[model samples]
Target: MNLNLAVISGDGIGPEVVREARKVLDRIAEKYGHEIHYTDLLMGGASIDVHGVPLTDETIEIAKSSDAVLMGSIGGNAATSPWYKLPADRRPEAGLLKLRKSLGLFANLRPAILYKELQDACPLRKDISDKGFDLMIMRELTGGLYFGARETKEVDGVMTAIDTLTYNENEIRRIARRAFDIAGKRRKKVCSVDKANVLDSSRLWRKVVEEVAKEYPDVELTHMLVDNCAMQLVKDPAQFDVILTENMFGDILSDEASMVTGSIGMLASASLNDSKFGLYEPSGGSAPDIAGQNIANPIATILSAAMMLRYSFDLDKEADAIEQAVSQVLAEGYRTGDIMSEGCKKVGTTEMGDLIAERV
Candidate 1:
């Protein structure tokens, strides 16, 4: 198979981590007798420095033409970077938002799994971490509160602020179907999270999700209020298989879930449209402080590449090779600084990448 990919090695440690991901990908190509064609482009601070804009029409076009996008973290220290001085729409992160919008990405899959080897790194109690949870948070992106129309004004004497939170049946239904489809592949359980008691929007979300749930009889669907779901995450994460939620709730819950799994450096995320296309990236930030130190963790980005293979290209065997290689590397006691612990052999970013690639 010929894999055509758009590589966005964005700002700070993005280039370093993405380089490692590509190295592992190269190994996958060689071992599987497949071909990979890479179209390297820039976004975020790097694009800002060179093109004076975080994203360009040309970059979007190239991304659209590719089979999938493999990306690393974007942005720098927001307080210190010149890129942040630009208008809000021109900032590095704004480019990411634009890219997702242009690519028509609606479903975000964030897997927060506590690996057995990294169980000690988990912040949860020893008993909780020992149980080990592997759950997927299917977030409905490009909708809900974030995209709603909003304006703040003073009515009479007092000032008031309002951010519209809206969801239609079509938007709700599509994401619900995607969640159930993913759940069918996993453990066939979908825990739909919403704030139905308080908000009309969430009420509508539940109604539509229930309507879609009927189509997937094999997948078990349940509902939970967002607040209680948040508490339940740390209380008992292993209980969840796939969490399906709307935008704002999902945005908050996914971050909360990532924390329990140990390091954000070990988590990978993917955003997908209705089609097979996807944008894969690490769940962590660029870590500007460690950008040039060669100590940043690249496992997240490497796993992201694996997601591109599995989700976008349907190369399940190839993806398994990369994931198994990551597990093997961790089992060997090799670690990057972020995920390092006592009694483990700490390695630099390049060496860590080399270890995983050689294993693959």
Candidate 2:
């Protein structure tokens, strides 16, 4: 199979980690007798430097023509970087938001798995960490509060701010279906999180999700208010399989889930439309502080490539091989600085990628 992937190596440590992912991918292509073609496209601050914009029409078109996208982190220090000095809509992250919306990548999948090898690195108590959780947060990305209308203006001589939270049944149904479908492949449990008790938008979200639930009877469905869901994540993460929620709540909860799994450097995320096409990326940001030191972890970005193989290309066996290689490497006590424990052998960014690729 020929895999045409659009590579957005973003800014900061994005390029470094993405380079390792490509190394691992090249090994996959070689061993599996597949041809992988990567079209290097620019976005974020990198694009800003070259094109004076975070994203461009040419870049977006090229990305759309590819089978899938594999991206690293974007943006830099809000305190120092000129990228941050730009207007809100012109910042690096705004480019990412624009790209996602333009591509109609509505469903985001952030899997937080507590690897047994990294149990010591987990911040949770030994008891909670011992139980080990491997949950996927299936977030509705394109709709809801993030894209809704809002403005700040004077009302009765007082400054009032209003941010709308809206969701149509179609949007809720589609993402809900994606969640249940993924849950069917994993543990067959869907914990739909929302603020239905208070927010009318969440009320509609619950209704649409329930309406969609009838289509997948094999998948057990349950609803939890967003507040309880937040508490439950820290209290009993093991209870969740696939967490389904709308935009704003998902944005918050996914980040919370990332922390429970030892390090954010180990988390991989995917954003997909209704079709099979998806954008796979690491959940961590552009760590400009550690960007060029080669100390950053590339496992998340590598795992994200595995997600691309599985979700976009439907190359399940290849995906399994990459995942198993990651697990094996972790089990062997090779660690990056972010995930380092006392006894494990520490490796730099390139060496960590080399180890995983060699294992693969």
Candidate 3:
């Protein structure tokens, strides 16, 4: 099999981590008797420097031509980076928003897995951490509050802002179906989180999701209020298998879930369209502070490549090879600074990639 990937080595440590991910992918291709082609395109600050825009028409066209996109982090420190000085639409993160919108990527999947080897790194209480958790947050990316209408104006001689929160049945149902489908592959439990108690939008979301639940009888479905769900994440994360929610709620919860695992550098995310095409990326941001130091952890990006293999290319065996290699490396006590513990052998970004690739 041949895989064509659009590479967006965005900014800061983006290029570093992306380089490592490519190294792992190359090894996977070699071991599996498959061919992989990478089209290097710029986005974020890199694109802003060269093309005078965070994303260009040419880059979008190249991305559209590829089977999938593998991206590193985008943007830089908002407090200092020149990229952030630009207009809102021209900033580095705007490129990502544009790319997702252009690609019709609606479903965002963020897996928060507490690796047994990294149990010491977990921030949760010892008892809670010992139980461990493997949960996937299925976020409805393209719809709901984030994309809804909003404006600030004078109301009754007072300055007020109104942000519309809306969701159609189709949008809610589609994401709900995706959640149940993925739950069927996992532990067959879907915890749909929403604010149905107060928000009409969430009420519609609940109705649509409940209707969709009837189609997947084998998948156990439950509903939790967003606030309670937030509390439940830290209180009993092990209880969740698949967390299904709307755009805003998923965005907040996924970040919260990532933190509970203890290291943002270890989390991987995917954004998919209605089709199989998807964009895979690390959940962490571009760490401009460590851009050229080679101390950055590439595990998230490499794992993201694994996700690309599984979700986009449908090469389950190949994907497993990469994931197992990562686990084996971690088990062997290889650690990057972000995930380093007292007794483990610390390695640079490149060396960690080398270790995982060699294992693969």
Candidate 4:
């Protein structure tokens, strides 16, 4: 098998982590007799320095044409300029938003996987967290409040900001279909989370998910209010296989559910559409304070590479091998600073990545 990948090492520690993922990919390529071609592109602050824009047209063209995209974390204080202060299309984060929208990545899958060795790293009690949890949140990426209109003005002597929540039948159907498919592969349980009682948009969301549920009769379907779902995640995360929701709800809940795994640096995410090309990234943001320390964790980025293999290339065996390599590396007690417990050998980012790649 041959794979063409667009590598966007955005900013901060993006390059460091991406280098690790690429080494692992190279190992898989050699072991499986697969040829992998990687094309590097700049984004975020790096692009701003080179092209005076956060995302270049050439980069977008290459990304859309590639088999998959591996994005490192984007952003840094250096990218902030006085002229471009928080404008929707000019902010550092705008580069990412533009890529996702341009590529039409509507379904985001965020997996919170807990390694048994890292159980002591979690804030939750050992007894509850030890049982372990692995769940994915299927987020509807391209819709809802973030894309809605806001009416802010003086109304009867007071200023107010109002944001709308909206969703269409097709959007709900597509994302729900992805959720149901993922549930079928995992544990056959799909929990649709929304706020049906208060919002008309959520009511339509629930109605559409229910309509789509008929197609997957074998999968168990349930509905939970977004508020309750948030609480239930902490109480018992293992109960969920796939928690699907509209854009805003997903945005909030996925972050909340990410904590069940204990370490932010251990989570991976993938954004996809109907096409073969998808954007895979770490759920954690660029920690500028630790950007150059060589101690930042690379597991999330590595796992994102695993997702790119599974979702974009359909290389399930290779993906599982990479995942198992990460698990085995952790089992060997190799630790980065973030998830390190007592008596664990703390290694630099590059060394830790080398250890995982060696295992691969």
Candidate 5:
């Protein structure tokens, strides 16, 4: 197989972790007899410094032309610097948002898979979190409150802010279709979460999702209020197969879902389009405090490389090899500081990647 990948190593730990992911990919290519080409580009704080913009047109062009994109964490405290004085669209995180929009990546898939070996690392009780929570969250990335209308008004010398929660039928239908498709691939169950009781827009979302549900008769579809879903996630996360929700709900829930696995660094995400290309990334952010430190976890990034192989290149065997390598490494008691527990071998980022790549 031949593959061309765009590497947007955003900032801070982004470059560090992305390098590890690349190493894993190199190992996979060498072992599996595949040719993989990579084009590295700067983004986030680094791009803001060098290009005077968070996301350069050249970077976008590179991503668009590539077969797939692998993005590491973006955003840091450096965003508060004088260079960030540019317009709203020029912000570091805005670059990511733009990339998603430009690519029409409506479906953001975040899988929360808690391995049996890391059960003790979780903060929840042994029965609650340790038993293992394996679920996928299909978040509507390009729609809902995140892309809604906003207004600020001064009424009686008081500033009142209003941000709309809106979703059209087509947007809801596309994401619901994605969720149902993903559910079919996994456990054939879909939990569509919303706040229909209070918000009128959510009612429309519910209506649209229910309408879309008719297209997939074999898939079991259920609706839960966002608040109730949040509670249920902590109570019994395993009950969910594919948790589908709007943009804001997904953003918040996915972050919360990370804790189910004890560390955000363990989570990987894929922002996908209907086209062959997609954006793979870690669900964690750039930890500036530990930027240059070798202690930062690279599992998420490496796992993202696995996702790139499976989703982007259709390299199922290679993807499985990478995943098994990660699982095997974890099962062998290797751990990073964030997900480290007693009796586990704590290692730096490079060592961990080398261990996993060696296994691959």
Candidate 6:
């Protein structure tokens, strides 16, 4: 198999982590007898420095030509970076938004797994952390309050702002089906979260999801209000296998879920279209503060590459190889600065990548 990937080593620690991911992928290719090809494309602040824009049409065309995109973090210190001074549409994050919209990537999957070795790093109560949790957040992207119409106007002599929140049955059903399909592969349970009690949009979401549930009888389905779901995440996270929710709620919940596991640097995310094509990336930021120090954590990005192998290429064995290598390295007490514990051997970004790659 020849796997072609578009590499977006965006900015800050993006290049560092992306470099490590490529090393792991190279090792995977060597061990699995597959040929891997990479096309490097720039976006975000990196692109801005060279092309004077966050993203270019040329970069988009290159991305479209590839099998999947593997990206590191984008943007920099908002308080000081020149990228943040640009117009909203020209900023680093805007480029990411544009790419997601251009690629028609609507289903965002974020996995939050508390590794047994990192149980001490978990922020939850020891009892709750001891139980551990492995959950996937299936977020419906591209449609919702985030992409809806918005404006400010004077209403009854008062200045008010309004942002529309809308969802069609088609959109809701598609994401629900994706969630249930993924749940079938994992624990066969889907917890659909929404604010159906007050919002009409959420009511429509609940209705459509329930309608979709009938198709997946093998998958057990349940519904929870968004607020209650938030509470439940900390109270009983292990109870959830797959969390299905809309754009706004998912955006918030996924971050909360990441933090509960102790290090966002360990979380991996994917955004897929209706097909197998997807964009894989780390759930953490670029961390401009540690950009050139070689001290950044690359596990999330490497795990993201594993996700690309599983979800995009459908190479389960290859993905498992990478994932197992990561687990083994952690179990051997190898740690990056972010997830470092007292008794663990701390390593730089490159050394961690080398350890996992050697294990693979």
The Cα local distance difference test for each model comes to 0.94, 0.93, 0.94, 0.88, 0.88, 0.95
Compose the digit string of candidate 5's lDDT tens values, residues 20-90: 99999999999999998999888877788998788888888888999999988888775565545767778
Q: lDDT by residue for model 4 over 1-360, one digit each (tens)?
A: 989999998877888888889989999999999999999998887787788788988999999999999999888764454425646577568899999999999999999777788888676777778678888999999989998888999989999989977789999999999999889888899999999999888899899999999999999999999999988888888788899998888889998888767798999999999776799999998777788789889889999999999988889999999999999998989999998889898998899889989888
TM-score of 2: 0.98
> For residues 2-120, could you state the per-residue lDDT of candidate 3 as single tens digits?
89999999999999999999999999899899899999999999999998899999899999989999999899999998888899999999999999999999999999999999998
| Runs off by more than 4 Å, candidate 5 | 78-88, 156-158
Worst 10 residues of 2 by lDDT: 256-265
**What TM-score would each prediction reach against the true structure?**
0.98, 0.98, 0.98, 0.96, 0.95, 0.99
By lDDT, the better pick of 5 and 6 is 6
Tell me which residue pairs clash in candidate 1.
Answer: none
RMSD of 4: 1.6
Q: Which regions of candidate 3 fall more than 4 Å away from where they truly are? A: none
lDDT of 4: 0.88
Predictions ranked by lDDT, top down? 6, 3, 1, 2, 4, 5
For residues 1-360, write the lDDT of model 2, one tens digit per residue: 999999999998999999999999999999999999999999999999999889998999999999999999999998999998889988999899999988999999999999999888788999988899999999999888888999999999999999888889889889999999899989999999998888999899889999999999999999999999889989989999999999899999999999888788999999999888999999998999998999999999999999999999889999999999999999999999999989899999999999999988
Show pairs that collide, candidate 4: none
Encode model 6's per-residue lDDT on 1-360: one tens digit a residue: 999999999999999999999999999998889999999999999999999899999999999889999999899999999888899999999999999999999999999999999998888999999999999999999999999999999999999999999899999988998999899989999999999999998999989999999999999999999999899989989999999999999999998999899878899999998888999999999999999899999999999999999999999999999999999999999999989999899999999999999999
Candidate 2 lDDT score relative to the true structure = 0.93
Please give the distance, in angstroms, between residue 120's alpha carbon in candidate 5 and its true position after superposition: 1.3
Model 1 CA deviation exceeding 4 Å by range: none
Write one digit per residue (lDDT tens) for candidate 1, span 1-360.
999999999988999999999999999999999999999999999999999999999999999999999998899998998888899999999999999999999999999999998998888999888788999999999988899988888989779888898889998998999899989888999999999999998899999999999999999999999999999999999999999999999999999999989788999999999899999999999899889889999999999999899999989999999999999999999999888889999999999999999999
User: What RMSD does each model have against the real structure?
Assistant: 0.9, 0.9, 0.9, 1.6, 1.7, 0.8
Where does model 2 exceed 4 Å of error?
none
How far off is residue 86 in model 3, in Å? 1.3
